[model samples]
Target chain A: MLIGACLFAAGLYMVLTKSNAIQVLIGIEFIINAGVINLVAFGKYDRYHNSGQIFALFAIVLAAAATAVALAIILNVYRRFKTIDPGKIDELKD
Target chain B: MEQGIFIFLGLTTVASAWFVAASQNLVRSVFMFFVTLFAVAGLYVFALADFVAVTQIVIYVGGVLVLMLFTFMLSSKETLEKLEESRHPVFTLKQFPALLVAAAFLIVLVNAIFKLKPDQLGWILQATNNTFRPQDNTVTNIGTNLMTTFLLPFEAISILLMMALIGAAHLARKERSFD
Candidate 1:
């Protein structure tokens, strides 16, 4: 649990500090990994319940699909601005 | 022996996670993220959650990370200059407060985890010992569960995947000119 919390903190740091779009996605991945760690940690003792395991499985699939969509959006951003930096592509403001 | 494996897994997970943060190269970061995912998956196996471990590897490592890599390849020309370009604005004194907030959150979390009861840990250990048997840790159980009790959620996931595919295609399609 100590390790899981530390991992989550590090991931949150990356997500907040990174300016590159891809790095942000990596940070999100780290956050998801932290969640996975916690789920597995909970699953460690609860065998018959299997709820944590089931939730982890669903989370993994959801993370994958979310990443796919995010990448597609990133590709679109690249096409429009020729840049992957989130700081640069601010044309969508109201 | 188990302690040693735990330490090794911990080191691998932390190192790859650091690389995911420290590497400037987007592709390298994505690859490191894959390694990080793999290490976490190993930890899941060590925790006796074989089904979760397999799903992590398949969905995260095999599917999502691959999509990220392909997007990186398709979206940019692999060049040093682009990679080196800084995307963040210059930070003023205002950003220090955000860092303070983050540090405070970390401290609180660490404190909470340390306060967990010894009895709780013992109960968790006993529960884990009873649930997982070596012989029954097969894909068949998961498959059966998904088909039977989890059928609705399973179908929903398929529909979600289909929507993602359509949305991605639409987002990446070439713009048409009416001239």
Candidate 2:
């Protein structure tokens, strides 16, 4: 549990401070992992139902899909702006 | 014995996560993310969620990490150069506030978890039941439950994954040059 806490904090810090889009995506992955750890840990007590493990499985699959789409979007952004830095790619802002 | 393994895995997860967040090179950070994910999977195994652990390895290690690596390597040379140039070797003022926020969040959450008895958390009823009637073979039970109770969600996930696949392909298609 403490491990999950540490990972969540570190991931959050990375997301907040990193200017690079890919780094932010990596940090998002970290946060998802922290949640996965917690879900599995809590599921330990409910061995009969395996709800936690099932949920973790669902989360993993979804996370994989999300990562693929985000990477694609990031790649598209790079193609257009010639940069992947979120700080630099602000054309959407007025 | 089990507790010792759990502690070791937990420590590994924390250390790798720290490296993932603090490393200077983006490549190294992604690699550290691999270690962090692997350690978290090990923790899942210790938590008696062996199937989830294996799924973590298959999906995270096999699928996501490889995709990240591909993206990293195949990104435009200019973008790569820019990434290398902006890499930070150590903490800077930009990160100080984020670190503070993370630390505060950790303290508040850990304190809350300690204060509230596990039983008091309404959703954690199964956790507090305490007898640990472990489903010795989780696969059969999980299969049965998915088929019976979670049938809808299980099917929905397949549709979601298909949509994601199509969407990503569409997003990444090569653009035509208008002459």
Candidate 3:
């Protein structure tokens, strides 16, 4: 749907444009949301199995778990760098 | 008509999402994320996914949004000035190419949507009708399918979520060093 597409674009722009680690994660959430919208819309047509709705549910849960893990990683990054900006923390080395 | 509510939800969802993408302050961005998600939940209800809509609110709005709020508060000293000071600019050298590509993608998708309306073998298929004609009990049907046909995936996802929780704990824990 156009709504989903618009969201995907906005999210992609954020992920690309923002140097903040948390902001990037927000963008990733947006991308997941767009997918969920499309899946649920398709589910409307599925009278028998509702596969789209099931997949959308799975996607939402998985997205939450992913955000938790990503936040943990970001916290660790902040610990090492004392900053949340992804651009400043280029190297893996502490 | 339902169109009125649908239009409102769509507008609010898109506008709040845009704010999330553009807001400068980290805290404001997180708050806007909550509004955007809540609007999306409303849209889910309109889509007739009652169970999914409820889960969206409970897990996404209630659970994830709270977690993000805590992260924002704990990571930074909260002040109104801090909110405005931490705002990042919308574009820089690293993001220019990305903006271009995403804009192009949006234009293409919109063009396709306009070109391929439902009757013209649309680019993507969608079902606008109520799926459960005989029975409107979506929750019951989903529960049955989860325990039966999709049992493996349902169980697997539970395991995956558990692992993710453990992994987050391990990663966030402080390191013990031998001095």
Candidate 4:
């Protein structure tokens, strides 16, 4: 649990500090892994159902799918804007 | 021995995660993220989630990290050069606000963790007393449950994955406007 919390904090920091969109995705992955750790830790006690592990598996797949879509979007954004920096991609704002 | 290994794995996970967050080089940060993921898989093993650990390696390490690397490579070279040239020290005054927010969140979560005491929950206590025999083979139970109780979700996730695949390919293809 403590480990999960620490990872969450680190991920949040990563998300906030990094300007790169892909780095932000990496941060999001860290946050998801943190949640998975907590779930698996609690699932250890639930020996029969073991739903936590199952949920973690689902979460992993979802995260992977999300990453795929997100990276694709990032690639498209780079092609259009010529930059992957989240701060610089402000064509939508103006 | 088990406790020691658990502690070691936990440290490995957190430290590598910290490196992933702190590293300035994008490529180096991604590699550190890989270490963090593997350490997390080790932590999953300590939790007796062998299946999850395997899935973590196969999906996260094999699929996602490789995809991230490919995207990194495919990004505009000028952007990579700009990012590489704009390096700052690990700790800077500009990042103080982010550090503060992350620390505040950690403090709140740690307080909640100690206060909640999940181990003392009624369901956990009952489950531990009645059918809590630790078994070596969780894969069989997982497969049975997936086929029986979780069949709907299993099918739904497959459909979701397929949609994501098609969507990604469509979104990532060279724009017709550019041709």
Best by lDDT: 4
Q: Give lDDT tens digits, candidate 3, residues B1-179.
A: 78998998898888888888887777788889988898888888877788999999999988887887777666756343554675556666666799899899899988987886734443233444535443487888788887888888899999999999999999988886512
Error of 2 at B110 (Å): 1.2
What's the TM-score of every candidate structure? Answer: 0.85, 0.92, 0.89, 0.95
Ranked candidates, highest DockQ first: 4, 2, 3, 1
Give RMSD to native, each candidate. 3.3, 2.4, 3.0, 1.6
Cα lDDT tens digits, model 4, B1-179, are: 98998898889889988988898889899988888898899988888888999999999999999999999898868778889899989989989999999999999999999998977878777775533344668899888888887889889999999999999999999978853
Candidate 2: stretches off by over 4 Å: B119-135, B177-179
Candidate order, TM-score descending: 4, 2, 3, 1
Candidate 4 at residue B36, lDDT? 88
Q: DockQ (Cα-based) per candidate? A: 0.58, 0.70, 0.64, 0.77
Q: Top model by DockQ, which number?
A: 4
Question: Which lDDT tens digits does candidate 1 get at residues A10-91?
Answer: 6776777666787788788778878878887776555555667666777777777778788888887777777777877878
Which window of ten consecutive residues has the lowest lDDT sum in model 1 chain A?
A43-52
**Model 3 lDDT at residue B171:** 93
Off by over 4 Å in 1: B78-80, B85-101, B118-130, B177-179
Name the regions of candidate 4 deviating beyond 4 angstroms. Answer: B129-134
Report the lDDT tens digits of candidate 1 across residue range B1-179: 98899889888888888666656666677777877888888888787788788888888778877777777677646533567664343343544554566568779988987787533677665674656666665456666666777778778887998898888888877775412
Give the 10-residue window scoring lowest on summed lDDT in candidate 4 chain A: A85-94
Model 2 C-alpha lDDT per residue in residues A1-94, reported as the tens digit of each score: 7777888888898898887888899889889988988888787766566777778888888999999999999988877777788988868723
Candidate 2 TM-score to native: 0.92
Candidate 1 local Cα displacement, residue A55, angstroms: 1.3
Best by TM-score: 4
